[model samples]
Target: MAPAKATNVVRLLLGSTALWLSQLSAGTVAASKSVTAHLAAKWPETPLLLEASEFMAEESNEKFWQFLETVQELAIYKQTESDYSYYNLILKKAGQFLDNLHINLLKFAFSIRAYSPAIQMFQQIAADEPPPDGCNAFVVIHKKHTCKINEIKKLLKKAASRTRPYLFKGDHKFPTNKENLPVVILYAEMGTRTFSAFHKVLSEKAQNEEILYVLRHYIQKPSSRKMYLSGYGVELAIKSTEYKALDDTQVKTVTNTTVEDETETNEVQGFLFGKLKEIYSDLRDNLTAFQKYLTESNKQMTPLKVWELQDLSFQAASQIMSTPVYDAIKLMKDISQNFPIKARSLTRIAVNQHMREEIKENQKYIPEFLPR
Candidate 1:
């Protein structure tokens, strides 16, 4: 064959190969997007428990699993890219896709916990070893700041002075603005959950903003506002949105069994979920220690009894409703309610005036005003 003709043939073959490669890549991309869309559609169909269910009927079907695998694989591809811009583009797309699908996922989780025993899916995912084929599909193993709830409480204590804007001021020391107090209290509650490795991923300001959003709703009621200012809102707030999101996220990483075909990524996710679950279980077991820290923190911040304060205190309470001191007060109140405590000896009990009046009315055996 002539050298020039042979070279032309080689070029022709190369062109054909490139065309075939491009076609395959395009098909993969389309498939990925389709899978993501389908998962989004199917996610809302069941509660999380059913989604995470061991029973075949309760579980997400093979189609949804395939979608998750594609996303997970794309995530791995992004991670493997050394080019920061390219990698980030992949990550951003993955994040947006995941965020859109979050609602359906969350609904399933919360609802299913009621119908079935809480399976430690995160633990299971975390426990699963990666397969050798470069795909395990569900783990994202990044190091997370794993702090105890008490440690988080301490961090908040250190940051108390910075929390001034969230407080309400009035005639008394540490008074809170009632209207704003509930939101701030809820914000504080939300803050507690962010102490772990999962939440440590966000900047402090961003994290605070997220908490504030959640806190805004929990404090809407007069009872809730009063509850917040009277020091009952703190723990409730923590249990409410702030920490709950963190807890829920932690649970999600594991229980959702939505792994991709990349071993490293799957391992990372599994590790994070496993760590989060460990942290959550640890917090649950150390509730007593947390309670002790709560008592001490409250004593240091506000020593006034709930009955001794006037409506003026509400201003102070409201202002600092997001403060660690407020959280301390809420903790004491929660303990008093749940643990069959002697109410007379509760520590750092700073009740706002509205609560005081309610107590007074209650003492007279007047019926509590139930909100319509």
Candidate 2:
């Protein structure tokens, strides 16, 4: 009788628990539905964009941007009356808030890989008439210019080499097409220095004199320019396939090493360190030469500070050297007596560690670029 009473008590508890869970689940579903309905009413296009954001959260920024751009382009093509306003509002808010939603929208819209959408977004953002001198506006304009150049190059490949350039007859008809107009505005607003380097490239490849003239006119246009400009040339230089090749080689060599063969492991480590040392030496030499040239010629190009150069050099070296360097340093510390060149290796390790810290410190000072 006592056992039966306990079982009845257990059944009652289980029934109550099940009922509570059912109520909780129902409440959650109702809350979610209500939120969705609210979002739909407040921003008619936001629900789909939010859904896209969730789907793309784990993907690369480029892929996410591509997807968002595709959605935007499709909306435009479909002539959805409300979508243009909706998208503009979203972009405006993004620029204003600079929050997760803003970042995600940009990551989905302005990736270097998604050229067309990047351009479109740039144009849209530019059209919002954000202060021309504002940092965010400058970044968007610069990216727009890059996209325009890339797009023009792509189109030029399909166009006849000798095709006549569109003529400008002073009737508000600049040679600038819909695609190139943003670039023109960027140059007009940002000044000649923004595109001075690319002018030569444009001149060399432009299909005709008229095209070249139009490009030159925009690129050389003078304006009240912002004082500071972000330099991406070094970053671009280090992002080549060559760095990836080195990384792959380093990985393979390390992975193929067996713990049983201490000599082979040491040999691999030695080889890697040798390569790293060579790269570091080359970079130091190049930096010295560049500094010398800058001082001698008094070129208008902004000179990199010594620490900046060191940071860049360390970053470049780390691409191929970080893993092997780390392992070698660890091994030496573990068995200092057995390690060859113990003192020198320790010094190198210290330097590398310090440089790593400096790089982290410098990142805080660096301006936030869109892709970052």
Name the candidate that leads on TM-score. Answer: 2
Off by over 4 Å in 2: 35-372
**Candidate 2 TM-score, true structure as reference:** 0.18
Which predicted model would earn the best lDDT?
2
Error of 1 at 365 (Å): 7.5
Worst 10 residues of 2 by lDDT: 36-45
Candidate 1 residues lying further than 4 Å off, grouped into runs, are: 1-30, 33-333, 341-362, 365-372
Task: Look at candidate 1 and tell me the lDDT of residue 175.
Answer: 19
RMSD of 2: 26.3
Model 2 lDDT per residue over 1-372, tens place: 999999999999999999999999999998886311111111111122333333343344444433433343332222444855655554443343355775675656432222232222323444454434422212122223333445555444434433333432311122322333222222221112334334434434433432322321121111233222122132222334553335877776676443223322332312343344357765644543443343333323344545444444354334335447646665544444432222222223323677677777988877665466
